[model samples]
Target chain A: MNDKITTPQTIVLIITTLIGVWITTLPATLAEKSGPDSWLMVIIGGGISVLGAAIVTSTGRQFPEKTFIEYSVETLGVFGHLFNLGLIIYLVILTGMVVRIFGEVIKVFLLDRTPIEVIILTMLALCVYLTRHGIEPIARTAEVLLPILMLPVIIIYLMIILFNGDLSNFMPFLRLDFKEIIAGTKATVVSFLGFEVLLLFIPLMQNPHQSTYSSFVAILMVSILYLFVVVTVIAVLGIVETSLLIWPGISVLRMTETAGTVFPRMDVVILSLWSIAGFTTISPMLFASAFGISRILKAREFKSFIVPLVPVAYMIAMFPKDVLEARKAVEAVSNMGLFYIFVVPLLILTAHWIRRRVLNR
Target chain B: MKGKVFILTVLIGASIFFHGCWNMMDLEKKTFIMMMGIDALPEGQQDKIKVTLTMPVPRQLVGAEGGGGPRPETPQQILQSTGNTVYGTIRQITNRLSRQLYFEHMTAIVIGEEAAKGGLDRFLDVFQRNKDFLRMAKLYICEGKAEDVLKMETEMEPLVVTYINQIVHFNSSRSLRAINYSIGKVITELHETNGNSLVMRIRPEKKEAVVAGSAVIKNWKLVGWLSDRETRGILWMLKEINRISVETSIELQTPQKGLVVLDLVNFTNKTKAKIQDGMPVFYINMRGEARIVEKEERIIKKEENLERYEKPIEQAITKEINNALQKVQDEYRVDVVNFGEHLRKYHPDYWETVKEKWDLMFPHVKVVLNVDVKIRRQGIFK
Candidate 1:
């Protein structure tokens, strides 16, 4: 929590977390609603995200070296623990949710015969293993996968677009009509949901200078990438086909074929590569949850404990009826996640102001 | 050392458990697809769509005398299956294969004129629905039997479908007969309002695939085909006219430059639809650079050439553009290029009132085409 020195670079925190959190699933899910205009919605959601990031970053600077949970105490007093406890619980829930959704998708598409519990446990195990390695391991993993993941994504996007897509599908341009377009932004906004995690890591930053700018840039890239996916899925799959499917982005992966060639169903490779994204997303949540418990309980070997705790996440995942129920369960928690993203910042700022006024007296 | 050990373990583990084909086919077993042709069987005879899948035999399989009929080592194979529906025929074909039939390699899809006219929408759905199918596969409306185009041999390339796919895509890219469509587009048009689609037409050459014509689709099914010239007109209204040719003639002062083909550059084509006293008028503005590609007579000086060629090229392109507008508006009676859609989005409330009449209003709608084509760059020859 000593933020007075040894801060993480703006680019490192921003790109590291951005690359880590942006697993393929979010955009893939959003494709159902936004269709060809999903990317535009990504930009729209991204813009809203920057404002959220700014509010969070500004509040963090006021507290000097303390992280968000620590500042929640200075702000809300007795309520600070309540805030911390809720967020930590939510984070654990989030880790399980990511693991569950990813496991189900892989189960249905690639490993239909594999038991869902086994799939969830295996993925959860990987997340726990990485959490034990700490933030630096996650960051290094992102660094390694960044070029490997992004270069191909960019190359594939350009190649698919060049092949031939019905521009007309995009044409009933902004075709959702205005009311639907605005409504579409809600879920699309959720996919770009990770910058809220920045509140936890601000103190760890080597140099928090221009952190907002780095975060915004990352959001912009996500928006553009999401938009590209939206456009491709819509232009290639059309609106109806896009909406009928649950994982629209995965469908896009299935379509990476060059006409008159032997290669077909390239999505399998994309899913394989995306395994890293999925892992990174879940690791942060588990690590933060473990870190929060350690802080609360004063436990040693906290990271090691999280790995064994994968069974707990696996158990929680089974509570949901199925994929549909699981998504609904996560969405219900979104109100709480939003509180963490927005409300906590304002609460911290209020606490700081009150603490300053009381101390001056 | 621990990290190294883990890395090695995972690498070996992935190889053992996930190294290959979690969701796809290996090369040996796949029935590779090139061209899929669908035609309706006549009435009660509607039991077969002369399905043809063209494949290439590698050089290794060529001219082997020791091989008995259709040797196992043959580089390529063309398999045909006849069934009632496109999906049905594909299934029948897959039954004959050792592995799944791969549609990712499909280059062009041909619907015989009859198939399209008799409702080919059902056939298109299977391709659209299949996750394994390539949306980028070029679509065509064939003039005669679709099997003819599929079965044709290639004079230049080994595979007929590859040659044709290139021809259609390349020319479409070049801004020639504007009908390059993916299956993704087909699905979209079938769903939305004022929704329509276009497909390229392919035919059999001595041994290669030829760009034959284009087809216009209405309500998910192909309605009619358009001439190559007409398809070019369709492109102008749609994608930006980047590098299309416009023919013109300039009466040279020093020497007569007769009919010349001008190459368009730095072009911008904008379409606007507005309610003028409660009537929708489409105003098209085109501004671009034009250069003389070929001329009956040549003037050496660049300045003189620019001065003489400017006015006629502008006039000719205006005429060319107006020609496209007339046909797209009147003959087709459908906004395939989405000009009306452009206006509707930017002006929603206004469109809501008059949207119903767009089809009725479009045919007679007055089109004002303005072209200000400037000559910025000419070839090295000029």
Candidate 2:
């Protein structure tokens, strides 16, 4: 407990802790149910996920010295270990799927000639190496690259504002019925799902008590940014164009005309920076998988596990034949795999709450 | 060290794949569209839509500021094509070009005055649909040859798009008139329930096609055009007085009448939907600051002129605005000002009961115009 184990800087940890999980399939899954209103789902989904985050934050505070893996075993015993393994397995698959999604995006949008396996393999290879470095380096990388990722986002917003942002795009507000909104919210709440990953890092943080607050702030900021992007894309591109286009963000990248400048195509700078953030996002998932497996195997250190798993992931990513199938597979992961994020966080809180009540009696 | 080497290798591999591909739109081979004009071909030519695209010839030198000089003598080279549809015309024109045209660089789109008056819905349909066109690009309805306005030279900007962009700049900065009439706003209005719209009117002023005013649209077609003065008046009603000066002359103490200009620096207009005597009534509340730019008579105290000038300018501005509003409502019968939308947003439920009958109720609906036009500052040493 007293050891100086390397952990993330508070801000980057908070951010990477959220984006590490959410960003990949959200743009695609939100598109599934609502078509254009998919962004609305991201916003609604973010809000619902906040509730899960609050519970995890409170529950993690109970065993400040323990990770969710340790605390779950303590709370639920041998059966709990089995349940924790199941959750870890779901998260590992999520890690695999994220590698597949980002690789597919790179293959389709950025590099058409490049094979999807080559792309996913390369990204997974990086992820395995970074995981071996431990969580602190991942957070440091996020800290360094987040600002660069933000510049293009700010530029896109200003471009929309200067050119004319159609407020009417959001008008006819609440166009979807309450039932659909609720359903959409359920599906999307997972888009904001990564906040619950805080439980896994409880032991790593120097101060677990207040980490939840940072998690909440990260969720709020991400939601706002998600809404900003969703609204901006829908406003400019309209519903039809937005639906068919593979990457809505890059389209906004291409839309901007640098008035009175030599440089015309600015999406290049944006794609390059976003790929770095993608690295931060993917590495954490792979790290989480390796770490979880280390505890399960009773290995000496989680770092030892990353090397062998890299090729396994690379081979798994190859299963998705192409970009379209890979994207569809990621969406399915978010849709079904979201239950893994939600159920575990909810169980810890409810179980903890009931335990507190019985103890009081 | 193995981890570092493997990680570097992966990053390099990924970079080689993504390498400079997403943002690549080569400028050298791309045609920079200067001006675009949309028109329905002449009578009996129902199958054809006329398009005039003005492109920069590179050698043509034009500038923006040279004291309103005569129209440049050079014959403006414009490519004209006719096709059954807007996309058809675009495709037809593309065949004539050596390079691909980039709609991203285009600044102004002009629909001829006749095409605007006839029906702009069919004409602007493609611009709204096309992926190539820019959202913020200015759209116009021309007074004459759709190509003539584009042919007009400027003293500063080397291209027509750059020139038209400058003329329309004054509108957006002040936040007047449908947030300065971008293509996206026009498209949005066409689709909105209340259906409010504006298209910048283009006419040859000096050597260039300066933005004349604005044309209002109802449901998707252009209903009426506004002169710059009338347009400013309409903008004031819509509460879009960004930083425009409203100048009118009147005698000061029986001295020779001088131009009294009120430079509206800022404004916020709120229109409300209310049931007054079982009738749907709209109340427009306007808050703005006016600055006196210039005057000819031996001026009284700048503060003293505030009282003397307030009532008349307000009345005059109000009268002009009412005329514009009436023309839009009573004659043209369009709610291009978005007074209806303001109500729909603020009072959505209340609007629902009246939504079905808003058309009949609108023209007769009592509009309570309450203006708080404040004179904040006067011109120095006038």
Candidate 3:
């Protein structure tokens, strides 16, 4: 019953989590703000995210054997319990938003007549099953599924670039307005929010010292993939058309025509693969929240908490009235995630530093 | 054992919910529309549009096995409906059909001249928004009503849409006159240029359809048309021309006149823009290699220089390009030559200042042309 995961598994988990439903809309979101300079915004956003991940990982490495809840309780005394609850709340809401968006996309593209509630509930059931096994099984599932899901997507992107890409669509390059690019950078950074899961998983890493390196490598890999996706989508569809579509990534796949091949269209194939990607993304967050609840209740096993939280997550997923409102809710949660990713880690590091200095005195 | 039974019950219950068969319609019950045509309603009609959907009958398309009898003349069903919006008309047609109308397999979309002139953004919005619509569908502007082009019978292929698609695919690659403008490409171009772009034109005849030239779209409305020769000239400037043959008559030193057909084997151009006195001036350098494909008379002597033949060919190309440039710039007042795009890519600062009034300034911009044509081969005959 050893629960430790290898560094490679952690890296895979990070990559799959960072690339949820957002990758499908990142190009359009970035393009809407920065026009043709969206690629530059992605690079800037990735650089900032790498910095944020470094701080969170360094904080987690300080208490290598304890989870984030344990370390927070030890650091802030009474407030630590409240902070742990906040973190769990954030993770629960995030999982709900992710599942809701996934259902929305599946309904629009694949199953036009399926009710959104059915889609949400089924996805939650699968995630609950995965989360009940704890982090080790979730990491194992991600390790086995990342390559199967990503390789085809990367190949299709490269094919589109080779056959249909127009380099001139990236014109008016490097001519970004300062204000617009700053706004675009903020939006792009929100997409990189999932990498903060390292704060919870770092304790489970067999080699805690390499946690920094693993997180860095994972964020870099995701950044490169994001860069490729954004560039290819913009190059083929152009900035104006890309910014107009709700799901520009899927639209790009739909427009791609692979002549003389067995499968002329690839949107269906890519979407089926993306459903797996969505599973990997939400399961980790679900596990984090359930594990946090068990730790707070002083229970030995997190499995019992998983089922009860499913209804909570389902309720939150159904809270949004429509797609537009769901998007707004996701953005609100992402902004809160920014606080936990940046401010909470900085608070812990400063408090730990001050405590050590006083002990030395 | 009790725990195991409970887990098995939950798993079996989950399986029922996960199948997601609610949206599934049997393949036999779905009718696939191969082509869609949009036209303006006839004058004094209540609805704004007339939509035609062409669905292929699979049984007739496959033909009878071992039965040596005449097949149905038209193996496709054409249904028409009228409504105010594109989606409404489609739904109106769906009301009468026995099976669900599917548009995923659509090959082409033809818009009549009246519809295109009224502005295409309204008609194109549904195609852009709906996921079932094919973005790769080829878009063409019919010379008259789109229904005429959709209903025209073709002896070459059983389906008229496939025939039109093949004609577009063949002519776009082999000739410079026809451009292969897919829905995706046209939408991107229209968005990039703010609704100023070009669309391939299709003209319906008595029994067949002709796909050639292009319709000039300005501000989302069809403003004018470009002839085949003019389209070729614009293609040359836009660097979209491929495998085009040029025919020119040249005078020889032997006091004989001959008609020379030269195949422009390799052609490339470089366009440079510079701002002078608040106006942009373009410098175009055109270089190509030509091989004589046909000759009416023997005009080349053993000792004659090949450069003599290259001069007339270059002049003819320059004149053709100028004619197209003049028509687009002066008559149409459209900048289909991509000078605005070129300036935006190379000189962003200069473009930002003039992009607002580019249409006004495009007609006055001076163009300097440099042509270098090399006659590489004089054919097998001396």
Candidate 4:
């Protein structure tokens, strides 16, 4: 846990974690809720999340060598410890929900006959092993896998735009009211939820002060990627078609065909890359939860908590029976994550400001 | 601790091979469906729909390409069954087959006139819900039984489905006579409350099949059809033209005895929809460049002759567009060219009120067609 990561590795972590299962489903969900103005919603929602990431990063910079768990206690005393325990529970539940979603997605696309429990257990076990290696290994793994995961996505999107995209779907722009745009932005906000992992990792960066700028850069990258995906799906599938499709991102990729290629199925390539993204997401969350478990128990080493936390995550992930229920569970976890990422940090920063200024005066 | 780590490594390594082949199905054990067709059943039949599946016999396909001593009797197999639902009939047909049925390679789905007219809502449900069906597969509406078209042998291509798929693909780029609609787009059309789309029409002849024209599907039912020329008009309005030749005869006052033909070179259009007098009005602006591919008797290479040639070609395009628009507005009364979508995108408030009664109001909507043609090239002798 003591090994430090550079600013670039932190950015890669933020990008990969945010790009998980949401890439396949966000376009359809946004299209259904926001019409053709879904890309606008993405920019607005991403702007709001950038403010949150900046706040969380600045707060981490204030306490140089300590993570969120240690600094919260230092600032708020007993209530801070209570908040730390709540964050730990939230992280565990978030890991569970993410694993459940990964399992369900694999079931739908690749291994349909296998039991979902086996899939969830296998993924959780791998994540557990990664978490046991501590934060440095996770960050390095993300660094190595980010390019491999993103190249295919970029190539597929470029091929689609160059060959098959119909830009007429973006017609009648700005027809949506402010209220509908706000509601659609709420869906985009959920996709950006995974960036909150920065809270736990800020202290582990080689230059913690640079995290504020690097985190914003990471969030901007995610926003651009999401905007590209959403706009591409809309342009390729049209608004009505995108809304009707359950997985418009994958559908658009599948619609693309390279001339005279032996391997024609772009969806298969997308799924493989998506698997890497999902793995990055699950491993980081698992590591975050393990860190939280160690902090709650006042233990020195988080490595001890990684193995025991796997069963807990596996049990909670298996709670959702079907895909619909799994989604509902994820929505609940996302709402909880929103509080930890925004309100808790904002309250801590406000308290830190008051303690330094008003009380000293 | 070292023993524990070694044991963990061994367990992890062993688990990969344990489940490596749990759900793997070899290529040989599955019959790859290349084409599918659905037809309506007879009056007294227990089932409401008849489903047909086409697949190539692996051994015969290999032998034919190898140019072996003798070709097999049948290179393809057609299986049929009847059930109340597509899924049920599919299950019934699969019951007799030894290998499992796979549909990932299916290139086309043909629907009979009866099934299409009866409504394609149910037939599309199976493809929508099933993960095996590729939404990119081409859809066709046959004049009679869809199974007949699937069973017809073609000399051009080894498989009838491959031949049909290639024709639809190539024809779509070269001319407006044949149009192909993917299952995904068709399913998307079904989602729209008043959206309309077209399906290619295929008619099986004696040892041959003709693919031309288009069948119009509006509100998930077949309202009518458009001939090859009328289909061209639809394509012109939709701006889907790639490289189509338009032949028009001009009566030159210069005493030319024979008719002249002009081939359209670069065709493009821009349509605008707006609210005027509490009704939707569309202004279609079309621009095309043409060449005098054939001339009967005139050898006038002067600029005046080219100017005179442009008006008759514009009139020819206008006449075709008007005829196509008239049939859609007066006879069938559907906005297959996406006029409603244009209004919905441009004028949302007006679209909300008219969207409910769009079916009734579509026939009365005013459309003004303005076509301008420029003679770009003349023959070398001219």
Candidate 5:
């Protein structure tokens, strides 16, 4: 179904995809590595991701009417099929870990008695339903849910900064060691891994040439939001305490008390709204993976492949035995995702350049 | 059409089975704990510790008349159980009661002197790790058994928990004698300072509970206590003072002296550290503004400068600060004024050299104080 998505819809898709389960634990990871300089590391990481997104978008623009799966075959022949298989595997594993982490967090904070298997299956069922509708519907759903996901987050950040923020927690500014900061930049870049969805969505845009602008705006928005999250969490909890927490974002919200108001506890409200964010993030990745499968098999409708992939994702989500193991699994999958997002795009561009210039085809 | 009907039937059936019924519990099936106290059991007892939980009785709270034969004297129920661990003790208490013990609404947690002295590191994890416990609850160290503080009666408030919570909020904002330290704040401070910090102190009297002063903790164990005046001094050094009255006798003429009380309205302080002779020297500068809130005698003339009253107030503050410094530095030898954190934040390189032996070198470090006070207003007569 060659339904076109507008520039604004593309921006919304990329923004929601970039923010997933990673937002809750990002501050703790950065605090453990860079201390008060976590905000600076986020900026460095965002700058690098912006450059990587630029490369991916420009490559997609080379063949305006073709998706990544289509153009890779035209440029590298047999090698492109292998690369396409790598992309599908990365997306499937990424979706699995996202669903698993979301289930774990909900079980801890909201529902203690519900089985985690029930949580995973329910979320996967919803994702499958959304993926069966194809790209235009997924983009529309993100456009509708972006405000619901962001307004509470922004309000919570403001309340924490106004009530409990301590400015001295960021003291001895910029005294971080050079090597430690470089190491932290690597972790921060992994949190920015979901932007690679642009490789599949660029060809579906109404004007594919504007993909660069769409990618820049989306990454800028997500980066500013992440910076706010890290700064507010560290400012309220301090570096040492933030590092000790599993979810510093939720902990910061827990510390805020809006007494004499209608809502005495805002953490529960913010978390319920955050479930919408989790749904938006997971559906887009599932859609991209199923679409890739349909293209490889020469099928006209991607809907046929959507149901079978659900059980595969369910099995992967259940692979990790515990929270610690789940984190290790996510790290392994993210490293593989980095290869597809960064190295593969550059290789495809080089092959296309050689074919056009040297072979004079 | 048949496939759509079958899919809809499956969706409806799944929703009926997975609608969060597994975790649902009715309000009547749970009991809300208002406050909790932990005390170390007496020597030679079977259990190591005792936990006391206070829950309000709903029938007594609403003053319902029909169902009860005779109303209870108190509106709350206090239950105590002894066990080896906190969670185990809670579960043991649950075995006797029909309703589950809920901690989401708990207002305060009081730790007894003996338990605090033993070490708090073991007891803090249950509150931090559990989802039911609230992080905003005020934490207190009692002078005696925590059970006595929870058992104390109040004339104004119906429950001791509400009484203690109100006093803490009021004193922390209007007076320097007490500081409100939430469990979340204490956890952060304990982690940052290696368990060297101050927690607000509470003591149970014959008829009431008093919330004042503070208890000093070193390496996760209670070391000593700071009195109200000394606590004010530590508050001044930490810049935690909001508004307090300073009373001192000022020289009016040669033979006559009068007591003048100044209301401190504004305060600001700056601390700087430097290394000299292999030791760290700290210089603190304090500036404050005050108004004439009360006076015992007419000691001010219309033409007399208000600046004359500034010197006595400054000396009074400096004396209070010095007394506190003497007790914390020489006697207890603990750094509760956050001097160690200040050094770590402003001087990271120098901190790296002495960070290992900071506990040994803390008491030897020298501190210099400078106070600047301004009397901005006088009484109505002036």
Candidate 6:
């Protein structure tokens, strides 16, 4: 928390955070709803999330060095305290949902028989360790690991295309009706939920005014990456097959073979890399929650909130009994996140505007 | 610093105690199932599927030139068990085999005609559900028991799985003798299409296995078979023909008017569906480039003769494709050539109305085939 993050670090953090478990599951969900037009839905969804990120970053920019909790209180007076509490609750729940999903995906792909608690705990422990150092260390960590995480993913997608991808899977483009297209876009928008973490981290940026630009650039990069992944999965596995898979991204990588390499399977390498990406996502969420709590209580030290919040996050993550339940819980959290992204930011901005007018008058 | 070290030590200790290492097995102790075979259970047996696993011996894969007493006999072991489900059957076999059975390297799965006839939907459930099994494994339908194909002793390669993989992958590029259908493709065809598709048919000879033709599966049940020539025509329509030679004879007013061979260099097919006279009409355009490989009747090595060669080649392809289309559309009554897929994609509104009766309408749909062949080059001297 002592050091300040630059706009590039913010952009890197936004990109990595935006692509968590969604990288594995979004294509299938989109395929289920939009058919081959899932690629179109990705574009629409990314555009919607870019607007969401703009709203979030702009709200943060209004409050100089203050995060969401402090800014909301200054804008709305006593009611802003309730708003801050709601955001804190939202971040904690979002963190818990992410932990559950990250653990569930790793369990399904890599460790079949591992206890779900251990998986969640291992990830939570890393998040706790990272968040204790605050936003600066997290941003720096993201800056260093972004390429390491993204290179393999890009290579995996490129390999699928070069090997034997059939573009016909993406054919019959724009075939979905208006209703289905909107529904598909909604599913894709859920994957872009993690980008809203910008609202909390923007305060830590060295140049807060540049946060909005960095957020848009980060979201655009993530959107293009997601577009490639969704199109690649559809092209390689076809629409119906992609829909049938629980994790089409991992399944698509499993379909490809790198002949000379001794690594028997590429999916293992991808899973390992994806688990690291999941670390970036979960750590930011934990930081947001702990940061929100520290800001509201006016505590000078935020590290104390990290440990006590672990048990709470661990409890919330273990709330879901199975993967299906975990997904439903994550969907609920994502819907709440959507509200915070669109409604909360706009609400705070409007409040600030009204207060400024009254004070000027 | 003291508290940080204490916490770090405790975290490492807890990780060692609670990590996911229980399911770990050494590479030496585990056995990889290179290929699997599913067959119908014996009469009076309660089980539904008899699973056959082909496992390669690591000791035999090592070069046998030096430090080898006699080249290791039986480079692979074929194990079988009967159970109601594929996973259940594998678990049953695991009890009989000393080593743990793993399927990460499984490259192919051969389904017996009997088992395929029983309905492939049920047999494919485990392949789709299991995370360990790869969806990229090539699928083959055997005329007899799949176990026979998996258990065959190969003359060239030591392992039957490698031998089968070579036949499927190599022949797919060289000729249209075998159709390459993976589990992913089959699943997509079954789920997305009208559940009518073709799987490469494999038959075992005494010392070798012949992979050719295709087994037609409709509604996930074995419907019939397509010959090698028929498969070539189907491949041509599907635009999957990699390299194939077509030989056809022409009647000319000459003493030695005879056959001409053309090696297909490139291929492309376009199928469009439209309403003609209030019925679905499929217009298929098949364009190909070929080189004159062999010719019996030698006209002067002129350009007109090469142009004249194209007409006879197109006619020959059209005739073969017509026969194949007739058998698949009229005789077998299956839309395995992706005609329904075209209708569903292009004419969605019409597809909605007739999709239910597609099985009835498929045989009656007027499919017009237009073949265009260009002789790109005529060898060194024509």
Tens-digit lDDT track of model 3 for B42-117: 7787349999999987776776665434755467889999899999999999889899888999979999999898
Docking quality tier of model 4: acceptable
TM-score for all predictions? 0.76, 0.73, 0.93, 0.93, 0.94, 0.92
Against the true structure, candidate 4 reaches a TM-score of: 0.93
Q: Give a tens-digit lDDT track for model 2, residues A55-145.
A: 7777788888777787777666686688677767666666676677676666545675677777777777777776777777777777777
Model 4 pairs in collision: none
Tens digits of per-residue lDDT, candidate 2, B89-182, equal 8888988788877776676788876667667667766665454666557777777657677666666666667767776674445434323566
lDDT of 5 at B132: 82
Off by over 4 Å in 5: A257-263, B1-23, B45-47, B63-72, B239-256, B298-300, B379-382
The sequence of per-residue lDDT tens digits that candidate 4 reaches over residues A37-146 is: 88889999899889888888888888878888888987888989988888888888888888887887777777878899998898888888787888889889999999
| Residue B184 in model 2: lDDT | 52
Residue A109 of model 6 has an lDDT of 89
DockQ of 3: 0.71
List per-prediction Cα lDDT, in the order shown: 0.66, 0.65, 0.85, 0.80, 0.84, 0.82
How well does model 5 score by local distance difference test? 0.84
Query: Cα deviation in Å at residue A58, candidate 1?
Result: 6.6
- Answer with 2 or 5, whichever has the higher lDDT: 5
True contacts kept of 5: 0.72
lDDT ranking of the models:
3, 5, 6, 4, 1, 2
Candidate DockQ scores, in order: 0.22, 0.14, 0.71, 0.43, 0.66, 0.47
The alpha-carbon RMSD values of the candidates against the true structure, listed in the order shown, are: 6.2, 7.1, 3.8, 3.8, 3.7, 4.0
Q: Give model 3's docking category.
A: medium
